[model samples]
Target chain A: MLGLSQQALLRLPWRRSLESIALPVIALTAALIIFGGFCAMAGANPFQVYGSIYKAAFGRWSAWQHTLILSAPLMLTALCTALPARLGLVIIGNEGALVMGGLAAMATGLGLGITLPPLMVQLAMAAAGMAAGGLWIMLAGALRYYRGVNETISSLLLNYIAIAIMNHLVEGPMRDASFVIKPSSAELDPANWLGAIPGSRIHFGLLYGLVVCLLAYVLIQRTPFGFAARIVGGNIRAARIAGLPVGKLTLAICFLGGSAAGLAGMVEVAAVQKRINQSLVSNYGYAGILVAFVSRHNPLATILAAILLGGILASGGILQRSHNLPDATVLVFQGIVFLCVLYSESLYGKFPCFREGEG
Target chain B: MAAESLGLWGIPLGILAGTLRGSAPFLFVSLGECLTEKSGKINLGLEGVLLMGAMSAYGVSYLSQDLVGDFWAPWLGVLAAGFSGMALGTIHGWVAQQPRVNDVATGIAMITLGSGLAFFFGKPFIQPQAPQLMTFDWGAWSSSPQVQAALKVSPLFLLGVAIAPLLYAFFRSTRWGLSIRAVGDSPQAARAMGISIFKVRLFSIMAGSFLAGIGGACLSLYYPGVWTERISSGQGLMAVALVIFAQWNPIQCLWASLLFGGAQAIGPTFQSVGIDSYYYLFNAAPYILTLIIMIITCSPQRTLSGSPGALGKSDHT
Candidate 1:
């Protein structure tokens, strides 16, 4: 019995991976309990709320379809923070990047006016979107680099400005006269809209999002440039001592982050909405911050985080319908998850079984 | 034609009213943040505090108006808002104090939590007619009804104005104020002098949040006089930038708040005068102005002129 107990305390197999996965799981379970308790306090059955969330998020292929579509944008927007975070910059400007990208794509698609082939028009719009988004975030990076401004504040402020600009365009300059009820831009040519993947309800944007996540992983974890960025993130003074081109790296990474988010915006316009409107500035950008944090800024891990959040988001409608709960019920759940996850960081390295114990 | 005729006079009067009302929230939030930051911690979660304050104030006022009478209900609401803010503030301060926790990340999470709780509990308060606090008449000299209406000043605004100079004095002379300044400028030195960094930060953050809650009351119980999900509208978040513009000085915070309020007033002022053109553009003014101010104030050469040496250290860690 003594030997068995000593063995149990000594180490666990695949200790590092197990600890990481275990900690997050524990945190998530805590979040579930807390959220359940909150629901009960708010005059609902906790079990039923959980049951409905599970049913809405994963009960059938239809729910899966909804989650998949919602997660596509989340993946791209998550990169908006994930990349900048690698350089130790806390930027929350994903919303602005997405908004600008959508506006830019709308303008490009309208300007093309079916003159080009559908595929070519799509490519042009994507390019325009990525460029606009890249430049938008790059401006924040430039401010941080040149002007010593706090990137987080600047990026957040940019989101408001971006929304204001979007409102101006859709409500004034880009407003479709016929659609007087809603402030919205003119719709794009139907042929230019992105087609769905074969036999699936999901759009071509899913492929783009997956591809970009893979590319970001390789870029941040593999390339020399990424290595230098890591070095910069680890310590700016040390990076400067090692002679990394800090300014260029900062601008380039921010641009990439913005481009990814911008692409998500283009995807939404081309795949789902087909027109720019107030709905385009949904809180996906804000949610992306939580995703990036939950994933610990690992580009590949962002996919899982996005999907989880997307599942929570997809359930918001069903929750309101079936549970008589407010739509923000999901937001409350997400917030609890975020807090639990962040707080659980302190729990790491504390478990005797996970550590190489002295005993 | 009438609105066009009233354009010049009504525009300025309307802006004055908006500024007086708008400045109250900004004043409270910035002042609260100033106190927190002055004690060497930056609470990015003030937005959440602001929202929670707004929600609680509205709910309390709505629920208590019948029991406490309308005159006293709003005051009680303001008090409840402060306590609600302290609750969230306590969460932030406690959790952020844990080792290995990033203050910035925790703050972001706190925003989600604060706003989440507000929305969750505030759903009932929406559509209820809460008792609104009375505004003091400051336009007895004016004969125009519109002018008299526009000249009405919230008592909270005057109180905020009064607090600024008082805060400036507290920072200048008091023992606790000097200690707060000491902790902010150099925590190591403060530690050597036997100050408990945890207690000071936690209390300062709570006090700051207490004020932010009052700012929220200024929103729901006074100015707009309604409870809604969208009432705060980033005003809570914008106050952080305003504090930066104020350079950690309470007196400067007052002017900065007025300037920001003036910027916000532009859109509504224009709409009131029937010059609705570029309304969206004008609404964007406060954010744009904040960005511009941050650009001018922050520098690459050295630390900001009055920035606390220990400010934001936890975020990097």
Candidate 2:
């Protein structure tokens, strides 16, 4: 039998929340210190390097716009991992879904041509992209739920296959003869291109990302479906005993998550690249995994995490130019952050201060 | 085209040679992953480990060639690659063993860390040439020059083939192997038997990573013979899927790796036949095949009999 104080120490709700936030914050600081040491070793002043990173990422309006541009796709892609995570599925195939989505969007746009209104064409593109992305991830979920295949490995393998398919289409059938230097589909008409926000270079994808993330937050935190998904995630056996449609929930969550990533691809095609190409398979999908992890799989938190990561990405060129750091310096920082965040998991619920109710 | 240079007989022979050549990396990586998974751990970071090993091997080989005589440089490079892999694996094993750490997430982090470290360190080793591992022409018996050239097999490939049986035997017969199996099947049982689960898993992960490092060395020092960022191109990840396809049996790993190697060889074979239209499609075949195999093998009705019971689960102890 435990004493009263021991029981209290184990029951502190606020303490758990505090420790969750504190541990990550501490880990972030530690990672920065370690990375600063790395920069110093590379013959750059650590303070100046950090200063440049800050300035380039957030100092000027233009820099802010660039960061926002980078953040938009990340916000959407992070949902691919974050949402399915609620169902205890680790889907890393968002890259595959994103590329497939982009391909679908491009194909739809090409098929629709100028016959439709620009707004209607964009909607069709988004629908096609979402549907394609949803189906791709649903396949992985179906494999996991029906075939018992591990989603992580299958999704990753699917990513490679998706990239291969993208390469085949772009280099073979979809190649625009005029663009021999870089194989790509024909560009979208300027009228159909995603317009910039008023007085800013940032596009409407940023708004879409924010709205989707908010909607996802509401869906997860304020809905019965989200409650059922959480229960399934907590314990599949119990969820099954409780008569939850475990398979349907898994499939649905995966489809929704995948659709978010698909929308990101659509955004990339309609809003930024304006054409499908190999570059559509950028590290944004991978980076989104990092973002989702850093946010602890919270959809709302993912927006903030994406912005932070986006700024870091936008600052890469400046770090290379001013500090003589390698182009991959940001990658090293990201790696450090990821490692620290993972290590920090050990600190949760173990802090003395977080222990319940002595006072 | 290089394939055109070889005739009809060369296409089948080319695939055979390619199977031997390409399967080396897969065999080593899958074997390593098998060892790790058998110890109740999964190190998805092997992709990054592969890249880092490739870079380290290339860097060491180039440096040793400049410092020491060329004769011992390649061997030294392979050793360095193995050590580097062990070091990274050590970090992963330690971090993952810590309380509350998620193995999958930790692996993802390690992937970034290893690849980032490699890219940063590998910038300088891009241009300088490193001594390549020696190869023997097994097809020397053939009258054609193309046959002889196509059958130029690296000693590493032969070594990989030989290791499969030895590893299978080790898992079946050795005391340490039994302990690893015990740990993987049930940590609670292993602990009751007075085994230190931590030590077994750590050592298994390190040893597995060492083998994976050797696989990377094969890529850089023998087959591709270059230090580049894209040298691995998800071969390590492919190896992970292959391990599952092989049902975690080392002998099956050998066969599965060859199957994958054959899939990879299809492109070059088609090119030899003057059908280069779907080259990217051929390159994509291995991944598609892996997915298909996984789909067919994975069944929800029953747990995979070959899976280590505790694989990927964080040990409370």
Candidate 3:
């Protein structure tokens, strides 16, 4: 028999990946148990509360529809984070871009004063939104490339600026004076409105988000651009030595990421809210970070993670109403899961058998 | 109108008031960050610390119903918030101290966790009628309402002012402070000199968190007197940026915070005057300015030379 250290080093590769996946699963289940205890403390039956949460989030047809609706924007916004992350750029400006995109869509729809078909209007809106977001993020990338400013702080700062800009437009110039309590842009005319999915609250936006995710997966996994981005992310000096257009790659990904997030704003305005408003943020940008983290920044994994998180978000309203659980409980769970997952990063590359045991 | 608002005259008065309101939180967060950075680690988790402070301070003030009578409430709430930061910071320090876990990742996780926990406890305190803390009326000298409004200095403002010079002195002149600074600048050198870098960083993060917690308390207890989901509103993050803008000098930090505060106040001032357009740009002015400043100052080949060498150094190897 092998010694204890040798045995510990002899774990299978499949087992390692399983453990990588299992850690989060275990953390989530443990969270449920802890939250269940919290539910019990708050004078609710844990079993019943959990049952209701599951039913409201994913068990029923209507709930599934809500899940899809929520997942659509999350998937796109998560791409805003994931794509930039591949280039080692921590761009948290997705919310800001989303707001700008929605504003762009609203401005274009109203400014042109043309009555177009729904699909045509959506296409136009998407293009407008994408362009706005693209420019916003490219500013950060440009600053980083040319000026040596840290992208994380600059991107985050830009996000604040973008939101402020949106708020100004909605509250000042672009506001439809007819509405009060919450300022908003003029509602998109009915001809420009996006249709709902056949069976539920799901919309054309979900399909768009999925297509983007698929496209991102293909781009990252297949393209020469993807290869260059990966090399740059792994090492900047090496990437430059390899004769790669490091600055161009960084700028392109940032633009693409920002556009994806901007599309979220576009879809929300055209297909869901039907107007540009302050509700554009709704912490979707922040939630997208959690979705990206849970998926470990993999584009394909982000889609699944978004669906899971969307379910939790959809269930939050139900939990608050039914079990007296605070709506922020979902946020708390996300925080815990995120922390646990990060802590579990220690597990990666630790097994000697998985590695070649080379120093 | 732009010319009327221009020159050193208009901006300074607005900046003074802004400094008073804005400096309180900056004083606490930067001081806390100073301490943490001195310990040779960074805690971007101050955002969560501020939120928790706001929630707990509001809850405490609401529970007591007398602002000054329950002056201890905010302190207690601050302590609670500090402990929360310490707990999270400790986990961060421990994990980062390990061979594998990245400091940036640890900080990000802590931020997420701290904010989540704050939101969780902050739920009940959202609607509480918080007792407002007393304000010092430095504006009483002015006859003009505009001048009066511009000069209404807060007690917390004065406190922040007093704290900056004191902290600057403490970090530069004191023995323990030197030790903290030594560890921050070079852990290898510190270890050679027999100082524990780990202990120094641990101490600094805890202290920085305490100050950040007090900043949060000031927001809820003194100025705003209410709690909401957006209570902190990235103030904690901006203050960290402000640290860089200040070139990591406490005195410079005082000026930077005031500049931001004035910029913040400009939006409301313009709104009050009914100059309706470009309000978004006005609101965004500070962040944009910050980005511009960051770009102008940060060198392409080398990092900012003025920073304490130990700040934000990743133990990646």
Winner by DockQ: 2
- In the range B236-310, model 2's lDDT, one tens digit per residue, is 878778888888899999999999888898887887788777978898887888788778877888656688999
Clashes of 3: 3
Candidate 2: where are CA atoms >4 Å away? A1-13, B141-143, B314-317
Q: What CAPRI-style quality would you assign to candidate 1?
A: medium
True contacts kept of each: 0.65, 0.75, 0.61
Instruction: Label model 3 with its docking quality class.
Output: medium
Off by over 4 Å in 3: A1-13, A37-47, A112-114, A350-359, B1-18, B37-42, B64-116, B126-128, B139-153, B175-198, B308-314
RMSD vs true structure, all candidates:
3.3, 2.6, 4.5
True-vs-predicted CA distance for residue B18, candidate 3, Å = 4.4
Provide the lowest-lDDT 10-residue window in model 2 chain A.
A350-359
Clashes of each: 0, 0, 3
Q: Is candidate 1 or candidate 3 better by TM-score?
A: 1
True contacts kept of 3: 0.61
Show the colliding residue pairs in model 1.
Answer: none
Clashing pairs in 2: none
RMSD after Cα superposition, model 1: 3.3
Off by over 4 Å in 1: A1-13, A357-359, B1-5, B315-317
Q: Ten consecutive residues with minimal summed lDDT in candidate 2 chain B?
A: B1-10
Looking at candidate 3, what is the lDDT of residue B150?
54
- Per-candidate Cα lDDT values, in order, are 0.88, 0.87, 0.75
